[model samples]
Target: MKPVFFLREALRALKRNAIPSFAAMATVLVTVLVLGVFIPVVQATTGAANEVRGKVIADVYLKTDAQQKDVDRVERVLKSEPMIKSVEFISKDAAYKTERERNPKAYELLGSNPLPDTFRITPGNPDDIAKIKDALAPEAAGGGRTVIDPAIDEVRNREEDTNKILAVTGVVKITMALLAGLLGVASMLLIANTIRLSLYARRREVEVMKLVGATDWFIRWPFVLEGVIVGLVGGVLAIALLAVVKIAVVDPLAADFALIAAPDTIDFPLLIGLLLVAAVAVSSLGSGLSLRKFLRV
Candidate 1:
């Protein structure tokens, strides 16, 4: 049978089962929102942790009384090293001011600046950090310079801690994805069952059509279309609810976590593609389920 006749019959079926159709749509919408919020939190925290690990830098402190020319000489040599990515000089005065700004109460009690001049050096990798430490130990050991091996070790320890956090988040992310997938499949089954029941209720009329010189295909198409229509509505509602969650909940968290990859959640193109795919899949499943009662096979 052609689609025009089936389309009219499908609309009539939907009008008759409006309450069940609405229930299925509402369930699908709630599922989308749960998955939407789950995705971004996993993305942002993971992104921020990686950014920190990829940008580790070590500080090399010097005696407060160290000469400017001596500091410049060391800076020039460090810059020439192959493994070093960058070297920045931090003067004692600058360090003092930074501390004061960071902790005003402690700064208020201080009589004089306590921080030493330092070099913040970023190396190419973990191995490069080891090489720089070996090369600098001899010079930092002598008469007046305030060696910074302790401070560099602290930075390495912090990187280790970041790695631990990443591992835990990875586990949590896996757990959430599995949970969401199960929930999605359950929602699909619920929608299919809803359409199946509606089809069963109208089986008498469908049998009459089949008996009155109607072909099997002609009698079956309308029930399948009815299922597809319900499925499509559920898919549309799911997409709309996902958009609301992204704007209302994810956007505000993203603002405060800008350093953590501001656009952490699903992008528009991906979200749209997912929505269309979900709609088609839902409709296909619903059609298959609902048509079982109408078709002899």
Candidate 2:
């Protein structure tokens, strides 16, 4: 059959069953709208969580009398570790200058620069902080304090603070992921049910066509086209609504909130395209599958 014939039949069916058609379209619209909003929210939240994780770092303080060679060796070892992302060395002079700038009166009483040279260690993953600290200062054979390198004075990673941040961020990410999965499933079911209802209303027509020797493809094309039409209209409407929200709400707030302005979030045009494709694909599949039982005649 010609494409025009299938499209005309689909249009005629939609007009004949306007209420069901409208209901299916409305279902698609709501699903698409929810998805459109949820995508950006998830991205922003994840980005914020990552920023917090990045703050979890380890500070390795060297002995005040440590030589340049010892400092170089420590830096080399840190850099060799697979779990360490970066190692930054700060001289005692630099540390003293920074502290004095923050509180000049506190430093005036000191006879000499008391701060030790420090190595700031950032881990590839926040959870690896304890390993990095342990690597630097493991327990001694007699259970006394010991350092992996004699030049190292102490290692601190603020374990309590790191654990808290990791726990909170982990829960947030897991919760968001689970919620997104659940929402996606619900959307699919809702759209599928709406399409099924439309198919149910036209079951008699399907049966009559089958009984009259109409090929399955011949019967399926019109219903699939009808679903495609509904999905296209619904998706376009949803995208327009999202665009208005982005312009009026998100864009205005982007200047004040780093989360909103972050470049890591999904691109708006790409997101819209994905939603449109999803809407059309789901509707057409739902229509085709829903017609299977009726086609058995």
Best candidate, lDDT-wise?
Answer: 2
Q: Quote each prediction's TM-score.
A: 0.54, 0.92
Q: What is the C-alpha lDDT profile of model 1 across 50-100, one tens digit per residue?
A: 455455566676666677776777777778877888888888889888889
Residues 237-281, candidate 2, lDDT per residue (tens digit)?
999999999999998788667443373789999999999999999
Listed per candidate, the RMSD to the true structure in angstroms reads 8.4, 2.1
Clashing pairs in 1: none
Best by TM-score: 2
Q: State, as a TM-score between 0 and 1, how close model 1 is to the true structure.
A: 0.54
The deviation in Å at residue 99 for candidate 2 is 1.0
